[model samples]
Structure formats: C-alpha cells, structure tokens
Target: MKNKEKIGFMCAYTPLALIDAAGYAPYRILPSEACEDRAGHLLHDNLCPNIKKILDRALAGDVPDLAGVVFVNSCDAMRRLADAWQHVRKDDRIIWIDLPSSIDAMAHAYVQGQVEQMGRTLLSWSGSPMDPMAVEKSITSFNRICAHLSELAPAFASGAIPGGYAAMQALYNKASTRDFTTTLEEIEPMPGKTPAPKHDAVPVYLFGNVLPDPKAFDMFESCGAMIADADFCTGSRLFSPVTGGQKDVYSRLTSHLMTKPQCARSFDPALPGEIAKTTLSRARAVNAAGVIGHVIKFCDPYLERLPGIREHFKKNNMPLLILEGDCTLRSMGQQRTRIEAFIEMLM
Candidate 1:
C-alpha cells in the first residue's frame, strides 16, 4: 500500500473514520513542550498551553509531513490556534470543525451535518470521493481498536499494567496515529492478570483536557498514587465504541461522536451533570481514593466546569485535587509537592 498523506487533527471531535474514508492518515496533533516561547510570542500567554504547544510544533516545523490539518472550534483557545495556524502555516491545508457544545437533537443534527461536510472537504483535498463502504470499514476497524483498549482498562485499574505512564503513552500514541488494525495487533497480546500494587498505592481517577507529558503520570506514581483510570482526551475517552443499531453510516458516526464520554466542552443539556456523573462513576468503578482534575492552563471549557466537578466530589466526601499546568514537564514538576501532599492525605 502506498503511504497515505497524513491529515493532522487536534480535538477528539474530528471524525477519524471520515478521514480514513477520505484516504488520509488521521494523525492527532498532540501537545508538546518544544516551542512554547515562540508560541507564546505568536499567540497570547493567557491562551491554553495545549494549543500553544501545538502551535509551537507547527511553527517550529516539527509536525510530520502532512497533506492538511484539522482544528475543531471546541474552545476559544483552539479557535485562536486555528487563526494563528492560518497566519503562521499558510501553506498547509487547514480545516476547521465547528464542534457543538451541547448534546441535543439540534446539536446532533449540526454535528452530523458537519461530519458530512468534512467528508466532502476531505474528499476534495485527498482526491477521494465519499465512499460509504470505506466509512463502514473504517468504523468497524476503529471499533476493534476501542475494544482492545477497553479490555485493558480493567488491567490498568487493577494495577496489572506496569509503568502507568508508558502504558498510557502506548495507548494514546497508537490510537492517535496508528491504523486500527495495527493498534489491535499491538495490544491484543498483552497479559491481563491483576497484579498486586507495587506500593499500597492510593488509586486515583485523573480527568483533564490534555496530558502532554506522560511523565506526569510517573509523577503521580512517584507520589504514591496509582492512576486507576483517566478521562483525558488523550486517554480512555478515545476508547469509546460507536453505538450500535444505526442503520446508516452517518447516523452511526454521529451516534458514536455524541454518545462517547464527552469532554467538558461537549455538554449534554439532558444530563447537565453527565460529565461529573461519568467521572464519579469511573472513580467508583476503580475504587479510586480521590479524584484529580489535570487541565491545561487557561482551558476555558475545563475551567468553566471545574466548579461543578468540585462540588460533586465535595458532596461525595471525595478528595479532589485540581492541577493546572502549561503542557510542559516544568509546569507539572512545580505541582509535585502539592500532588505528594494530596496523595499523603489520601493515604
């Protein structure tokens, strides 16, 4: 098979199945520490560090060879990042996805329409038409990937997986960049036995917008906590399966996007407390001793929802620690003392 042109995308809302159907590689543009200074100079300092890091990568010419890129208007920072990319990387084909914040009938319709439009745009860019069969094939393949990761969730929660950071890195890395078949082949052979905790580790549920540094997971482990599970866009949130029973491809795709465990930016008006409920449910499922909200600095969506998340934990008498960092190890390092304290308190 000839190497497919990579289409870089930012948010989870970007439909990878559609990208695959359009004959492009759906490479997630992850955040990194490489070009923060340059990004800060280009964009404002108060913007979300996740977006800044991505901008830095693009501006520094660190991103892989790409035919195009996609940015979802999930938040103000992301919108600004798309704007900055237009100015800095004008040569790259950039596509903006107007993601809906609410999960209602209207929102679903809007998302379905957007997905259809994105399909057409991707087809135009990649010289591939919208093939329903290709989309279905992609969906089936991705669903298998989701299944493999879902199978490992219990292992991670039970402390069976050694090196939480490495495990998470492998999980996110494969899901973001690799094809579904490759991802499945890589994970299917892993052992699933529950291992005893290396320490009497305090199990904690970690949720956030982005975790750029996997070493941050190491920091948590060093602080005497086990990341029982995570709700990061880069983590378990990617493991959601497309809901079954949809007769058509578009509806199936829309169902998958809308029903997955949502980020703070994607609201469910029907269940205003859904995000908090989902977090609490996951924490309870893993017998987590506490909850950690790790978000990038100036992430408007996560920031807006933090109060409700805090209240949910407080009402349940659960220890909740909110750590805001700038998508860099140095920023994460500064919070080590606090993280240790929180772990100690949990113990």
Candidate 2:
C-alpha cells in the first residue's frame, strides 16, 4: 500500500459500520446517477442497476479516495461487480466477502468463518494484529453508532429528516467518522418529538431497496403517508445485538450477519412467495396500513417477482405501490404520482 493511500472497503451498511470501527474508511457504493460514457464499454447492458451505477461512478472518478476496495457479495450483482472491476482495472486491490443469503444455522457458521478470514486479511493489509483492544474498541464504537441510528427512527418516521437523506447521512458518517463526528453526535437524540403527525398520514411499510434517497420517502410524506417500518438492509440489519458480552465479538458479528432481513434474491425455494409473505407479515406487525415495494431498476430477481408480491399484498387487503429506484438517484415521478393516488384512495 502507498504511504499516503487510504485503505477503504465498500459494502452495505452493516459491514460498513463494522469496518469503520476497525479504523478503515468504508464507502457504501450507490447505483444511480451513473456515468455511462466511462463504464458503458466495460459492463453489459443487462447488469444489475447497483453494479452499473457503481461502475459508472468509478469510471467517472466520483467514488471516495481510497487505497483499496472491499466488495461484499451480498447479492449476485455485487459479485459480478467485483469481476467487472477486476477485468477492467487490475491495479486496485479488491477484497470480496461472500455474504450468505439468510439467517440460518448454515449461514451463521459461514459468517463466523468469513469473519475469521476477514481478520486474517486485515492483518496482512494493515500490518496490525486483530488484537483484543482493537476488537473491543470496534465493538464499542459500532454499538454507539447503532444507538445513534436507533434514535433517528422518530425523525425518519416523521417529516423532519428525509429517509434518503438520513440513510445517506448514516453512510456518510460511517465513511467519514474521522471527518464528521460532531454531525453524528448532533443527530443522536430521543425520537419522541411529538409522535409523527397523524394528519391524514397513511401508514406504509417499505421493503426491497436498502438505502433510498430521502426525497422518495419525502414524496410519500407529501402524500400524507408515513413509513411506519422498513425492512431495509441499512435501517434494521445494522443493529445486530452483541452476543454474550464483548469477548465473543466473533459470534456477535457472525450472528448479526446471519439474521438480518435480506432481498428477494436471498429468498429460498419459495420463488418470491416467501418474500412477499415475510414482507406483509412484517408490515402487519408494525401496524402499517399499506406496503411500498421499492425495487432497483433492472434488478432481475426483484423485477421478475413483483407480480407475486402484488398478489400477496392484495390477499392481505394491503395496497402495494412499486417504485423503481437506481440507488444513486430517485427519479420515479410517474410512480410517485401513482403512489399519491393510491394513498389518496386508501386514506
């Protein structure tokens, strides 16, 4: 590694937080606002939106400055992203973490194994031992971060902080904690600021995309709809409780990885049916009146399974609105109009 080169990892929210605590600048790569001219020649047209978006930004030099890249294989698109990057540019050192699909026994074991492997890799790259002090500090810092995020639920549920902006802020803080500690500290407050306005606000449960722009959720709020709950990778999955105190950092990290809610591609043999059921069940649990299905544009797994999800929501007498997103940007105006109309009809 170059003396001035900053080491960084690119993963979803959970690992991003953990890596941040480990003293590495981790960036969450979004998929929209892509620079087609730069990356168009490298990847195919049929690639997933998240992959396309990241590649586009990399080609355009929009990504954060870092010495290395860590790509987590949370989904197929991400795996292919690593492949495409390696083929196009072999100079950057890339580490790919093979994340499992669900929270099961097998997955848990796999996660534990992966954590050990990651520890070894970090040791080689950073030339620092994965000692007890570093591990404890990382766990403590992450716990503090999770506490801060939990405090934002009320603001997120309310109109104060747009979900997209809040989500992006979470990423920004995780990526640049060394640069923005005060901002994170400021946002960490109790959420009981006069329970989210119930003024004709339709309660909607968001599912699918992990971190969307706050503007999209703000659009829902404009229509008097409140996001009562979200099964997002960023919102819910990041708060994995530590197991058996600090000594078992390994188990805590692995267990959290295994149990978090996953995308449609992560569903088992049920072919979208299970995911729809899981989503609706979660929606009902949160007392949400309806569901908002946000799928990344050109994400084949999610795109091919929307119909089944719609039918499942219909059976629950719950209105489902599908919004097409590209991670980096939220430009679904037509869908926004439809969502407003649906909320109007439902309310």
Candidate 3:
C-alpha cells in the first residue's frame, strides 16, 4: 500500500472512489491542529479556520508526499484555500472542480462531467488504462464503507457503541486517510453490545462545520457530556452512502454527494429548514437533552444559517448552545467551561 502514491481531496463532496480507481490512495485533507502563521501570510486570517489550518499543513510540509490534489470548490473559503495552496506548494498537479451549488438534474450532469474529467486526469497520471469495469468495482468497495458508516452512526449516537462518539471519531479519522478495503475489514468486527452509559453524563447532539480533532470528543466526555449524535464535516458526513441509482457511476456518485446530509454550504429551496429539521430529528432519535452547534469562526456558510437554526430549535422546545472557534484544540479548550456549564444546565 505504501508503494502507491497518494492524491489528496479537500472536500467530502469529492468522490474518493474515482481517485481510487485511478490507482492512487485517496487522501482526504481534513483540517488538522496546526500553527497557521505560515498560511496566514498567504491567505486571509478572517477566512474559515478549516482552510487556514489545512493550508498550514501544506506550508509546513506536514502532509504525505501527495502525487496531486483534487480540489472541489464547495464554498468561497474552499476556493480561496485552493488558490492559496498553489502559492504555498508549487504543484502543477492540482485539479480544481467547481462544485455546483444547487442540486438538480442539470447540476448533477455538470458535476458528473467535471468528475468524469477528474477521473480521466487521475487515470492519466496513474498511467492506468481507462477501465469502466475497474471503476465500478472500486466504487462498490468504497460504497461498503459508506453503508458501514451509516450503521455505525446510529449505534454510536445511541450509546450502543462502547466508546460512544469519540470512538466513532477515531474510526472516522482512519477512514479519512487509510485505504477503504482495509478500513472496512478493520471495522467489520468493531460493533458489539452497548456499553454502560457514562454515569450521570448529559447526552448532547453536536453539529458543526468542522471538528477534525477527535480529542474534542474526549473533551466533551470530560466536561460531563456524552455525544448522543453528531453531524460535522469531519464526522458522520464523511462517508454518506451513495444513494442507489441506475445511471452511470459518476452520475450516481454526483447525485448522492449533491443530495446527502451536507453542511450549510448547499441547500434545497423546498426544504428551507432542512439542516435544523434534520438535526432535530436525529437528536430526538437518540433522545438527546440538547444540541451543541460549534461553528468555525468566519465560516460564512454555517454562520449565515445559525440564527435560523437556533430559532428552529427554540420553537421545537430543544435547548441549543452555540459556540464558535478557530478549529483548533485551543478553541476546544476555551469551550470547556461553556460546555461544562451547558451540561450542567441539561442535567
């Protein structure tokens, strides 16, 4: 596995299966805890922390030797990050795909064409012949990981999993960087009977733009909160099952990602309160006492929708705690007091 080169993808919307079929390991470049002083000079400090932290990795050379990177412009910050990436890391192998903001048949077709181009580019770089059958096989294996995550999410949320959401985050962290087949095999035996609940812990549902540090979950545990469920960019949203389709593989992949549970970057006009409604429903499913919304500072997509979501929760008679941070452990540390207070209130 180490023999193969790695190609990084920044957005969860980017299909890793396509990269996998092209004979490279798909590396999801999740935001990490890092000092962004280097990246700060290249990009605006007011931009989303996820972007800053990610660019810091490139500037610091903290990443593996990536053959190339597939950038999907899911939001404005991501677009800026991609531009900054080239400046910090002089790589001509960067492929930027402008993700369609709306979900529709036309939009899906456009993205399908884009990912089709992406797939072709990756194949050329890998020196692999374009084989539709191989792509299909690769996607099938990757889809298994998605389905597995769908199942794991509920168990972890319901406290049926031994380590709760922190354990689930550990699983997600591996799935982000490791090979899919190995991840599936490793997780196949992971589920067991429910462990005893955290004694007197407040079960809270957490939703946010990005929380890549799994230790954040551990922090919640220490603060007297049990993560009843979570919907973060780095959490359950990582590996959504490609919804079934009879269309071509790329089209199927496009449709699923375009329509899955997403961050506030995209939305359906028909469902104005989709995110809040979904969060409420999922939290209720786990019988959570409250919801914690941790948004990255300057993340406009999530921030713009915050007030509306808060109102939705208020109307639903659910307790909501809103927190903002820079996507770092220090931010998580600052949040400890607030988190502890919230848990105390819930208890």
* Backbone clash count, each prediction separately: 0, 4, 0
Q: TM-score: which is higher, 2 or 3?
A: 3
When summed lDDT is taken over every stretch of 10 residues in candidate 1, the lowest stretch is 191-200
Candidate 3, position 211, lDDT? 85
Q: Worst ten-residue run, lDDT, model 3? A: 190-199
- Tell me the spans in candidate 3 whose CA falls farther than 4 Å from its real position: 153-164, 192-199
| lDDT to native, each model | 0.79, 0.62, 0.81
Candidate 3, pairs of clashing residues: none
The C-alpha local distance difference test score for the whole of candidate 1 amounts to: 0.79
**lDDT digits (tens) for residues 4-61 of candidate 2:** 2344444442344345444564445554464664554676766666677778877776
Give the per-residue lDDT of model 3 (tens digit) for 35-105.
44667787887888888888888877888888999888889888898888888778648887777766888
Best by lDDT: 3
Mark the regions of model 1 whose C-alpha exceeds 4 Å error after superposition: 156-159, 192-199, 270-274
- RMSD to truth, every model: 2.1, 3.9, 2.1
Which is the winner by TM-score between candidate 1 and candidate 2? Answer: 1
Our tally of clashes for model 2 stands at 4
TM-score of the candidate numbered 3?
A: 0.93
